[model samples]
Target: MGKTTGTRRGAWAAIRRLAASDRAAGLIMLGFALIGLVAANLPLTYHLFETIAETHIGIPYTNIDLPIGHWAQDGLLTIFFLTVGLELKQELTTGSLSNPKAAAVPMLCAVGGMLAPPILFMLVIALFSRFGPGEMGSLILTTTGSSIPFGEMAHGWAVPTATDIAFSLAVLALFARGLPGSIRAFLMTLATVDDLLAIILIAVFFSSVNAWYWFIGIAVCAGVWAYLVQLKRVPWAVVAVVGVLAWVMMFEAGIHPTLAGVLVGLSTPAREIHGETTPRAERYASKLQPFSALLALPIFALFATGVHFEELTPALMLSPLVIALIVALVVGKPLGIITTAWLSTHLGGLKMAKGLRVRDMIPTACACGIGFTVSFLIASLAYTNAELSAEARFGVLVGSLISALVSGILLSWQSKRFADATTDATR
Candidate 1:
């Protein structure tokens, strides 16, 4: 009996140790991201960055190969969306977003948040772009130009919208042991609202020139989704087939193919099964999650962010494209999130976790600025023009990295201070 208890305790301790290790590795990856940012901007690293940027990998059976980056976003990241969809389903079933009443404030804030950013960005462009070459002093937008010719301000619409959850949670993990649970919940709540808004913007605003055939394909994809919901003995393979078809259909439909993920995911059922083992739809999402998180996301991040900076030029760094991304994510996300949440909490009577205060919000809001994966994806969808995509992708790297770092710093400092205060008051 003594031996068994000792072994059991040892095993439990081992599990806890591993969990800690994973949390550490996550931060280290952020470190790698910082180094990557430095490498991307280095004058001597240009060749390496270009080589990595241009490298391709794809489905082996066909002649179809995309750069490592594209494979990550479109191919691998689809799995990420699958997981997101699954999470959304679970939320709809029993989680925070389960009911309309509970969801009202976050949903409304998310929509307003999305709309406000683009409108704000467009106004920024309308005002700044009129000034002509070298205008706005240093505040020029890097994402500019959508036939709108706002310099980099053209891409500004994309900047304020992204919130990187993995990075935010990483910030919380640094001292999550001592922090109030409500704060983490609040961050997740806000970011999830932010995500729904981001998805809508991508689907509606960023759509390509209409293709009727693609629209039909989308209909077929919708049918497949319906089948997934209706079929009594839905198989994982069927879900996979439908998911692939959804991607192809979205791509053909002149819609952003990644939105296919949201479609497929939303279509998946979260129904509890009776007199059986795993349910078909939930099983598929569960199996897909590991692949998406461990393999797909990391590979995507490495390739997408792995640029060498040998080509770094002061001119490029100061370009409107780069600066616009910085402004959108860095300046825009925090302001948009905080202002919206404040209004929602005060005016809309939205409830947050207890012990949460607006002042405690700044760090979490800053953390939301760490928009890595989706931000990079949106930068691609923002403009189909190749050179524009590359420039925007580079800008994503810069803005996201800077945002993650600063957010981490702010969150860490705030977490410590809050913990100390809580301990003092308790005493």
Candidate 2:
């Protein structure tokens, strides 16, 4: 019994360590993604995998019958978003983002990164439309025997605008090891802002809120949550109940239920208001991050990225949407981030953190293109057709891979240069 207990303790310790590292999370998610893709494509496993993913679990007397894939996207993904909200709260209230001057560059970068992709995506389509009747024209024709409307295609413009915070930070952890913590801080702040913008876009454009009055209930629940959090003796169970009720209310309102996580996170006091053992943000993040990083994200990746190989034809690869996505993610993300950051430094008189250089920021900007999770979510929201959604996901995967590879190479060179300079100084 003692031996078994020791083994269990060791296993738990290892899991905790894995959860704590961004690199581990990234690698784990990447592995699961690969597994999903393989399972999706292999002749022997494809049918089984597709069946499982497509299986719908119905809730009796309710209209909540959704497939497993939808559950992963709408339900499981909320945990990851909750952690993101906590991080955002911490940064805005007390962390690096607290100082407006210090965060100016990243703030600009975030805005640029969000705006550029959709514009570029639409432009690519517009240019292709000028062709009138050609490869681009045929490509826009959906499987439904109808040509995709400009508005329908444009709805997907926001798909590539997101930056996958977990994956990008993981790459940074691996390649920029021993670098200044400020670099991580800069990336974190930028990605958090990028995500916040994505959330706003979803709420504004993607949502179809049928019953706006449900928001009144949501507001009430949120207010109650905030009140309980402010009390000297906090009732966490009550907070959890209220949070769920708020989520349900939002869901009923036709708004994305995940935003409730952000609401609760934003409602939490970032600092220690009641003289607690730890700050609310830190405590919640600690409690939740492990679940988000280790399980929620990887499972989502597995469910979301299972693209079949038959869809990867050369003509389809060269289609306008595919081209737009690749360009938006690979080119637009870094260009937008870097250009805006540079302009901010000049106009806002922003100063880089000590031990950080302009060149270092470039690769990190490149890394911003690694848009995976939220991008997938946007793709689903944008495209109802399975074929179009699959194409979008494929483009995201390819673009994110290119971004990661390019950023890794540049970061390695930067890391080497920094090491050489440090060694020379020591000499």
Model 2 lDDT tens row, 181-268: 8888889889988989999988888888877788899999989988998888889899888987887787778888788888888888
TM-scores of the models, in the order given: 0.78, 0.92
lDDT of 1 by residue, 260-361 (tens): 777777776676655546544566666665465556666667655655433456666665556666666666767776777688888878865567766677
Q: What is the lDDT of residue 118 in candidate 1?
A: 56
Q: CA lDDT of 120 in candidate 1? A: 53
Candidate 1 displacement at residue 37 in angstroms: 5.8
List where candidate 2 sits over 4 angstroms from the true fold. Answer: 1-10, 132-147, 231-234, 313-316
Give the lowest summed-lDDT range of ten residues in model 1.
138-147
The per-model lDDT (C-alpha) reads: 0.65, 0.83
Clashes of each: 21, 0
lDDT of 1 at 323: 64
